[model samples]
Target: GVASVAISKCCQVSDVFTELCIASRTKSKCDALAAKLAPTTRTKITTAQVDADDVQQLCDLINSYKPDLVMNIALPY
Candidate 1:
């Protein structure tokens, strides 16, 4: 929880993060976080429903986003 918030906040302040995708298996949580940060940050925030354990899903997201960086902060349930 702390890590996700902290990272998102960091991204908010830095020019390096022009865009951020806050993905989680629980997409509502990601949406909440994105909503909280969206008003204050210039970073373009988006949310996606994703299962961290699924290789194909992860790969698909990576391919689609083609991000310069990726942070997997998901915890095992």
Candidate 2:
């Protein structure tokens, strides 16, 4: 379930760039992944509820987190 491209991009960036995954659907799932990635990787992962379809919600999350990049992992259904 790892995002290879995201991980690769993170690796290419500075080692300190924190990695955050938007778990809009399930917090537990995000927490589990964060736990797995925390020990081995230089990046740190956090979760937030961000429904990409909802622009306002997404914007709110962006403003709150102030991340350099936002990766969309949700299905485009």
Candidate 3:
């Protein structure tokens, strides 16, 4: 939660985060976070449903998004 908030704040303040895709196993959470920050920040936010435990899924998402950077903030527990 804190990681998402911190990253979203950075997106809001800095131009470095021009485009952001918030993906999580629970797509609703990602959508909610994006909706909350979309109005305030210029960062283009998108949400996708992804189960991080699945290597194929993660890889496919990475390939599909083609982002310059990726942040894995979800705890491994």
Candidate 3, backbone clash total: 0
Ranking 1 against 3 by TM-score, winner: 3
Sort by TM-score, top down from the best: 3, 1, 2
Give the number of colliding residue pairs in candidate 2: 0
Q: Top lDDT: which candidate number? A: 3
**Candidate 3 lDDT tens digits, 1-77:** 77687667768765788888888899998888888887788888889999999999999999999999898987879
Residue 75 accuracy (lDDT) in model 2: 57
- Please give, for residues 23-72, the per-residue lDDT of candidate 1 as tens digits: 88889988888888877888888889888889999999999988898987
Candidate 2 clashing pairs, residues 3+ apart or interchain: none
After superposing candidate 2, which stretches have Cα over 4 Å from the reference?
A: 2-16
What would the per-residue lDDT of candidate 2 be over residues 4-70, giving only the tens digit for each residue?
A: 4465466455356756554565667666666766666676667765556788987888888887776
| Greater-TM-score candidate between 2 and 3 | 3
User: Which residue pairs in candidate 1 collide?
Assistant: none
Find the candidate with the highest TM-score and give its number: 3
> TM-score for all predictions?
0.86, 0.67, 0.90
lDDT for every model? 0.82, 0.64, 0.86
TM-score for candidate 3, please give it.
0.90
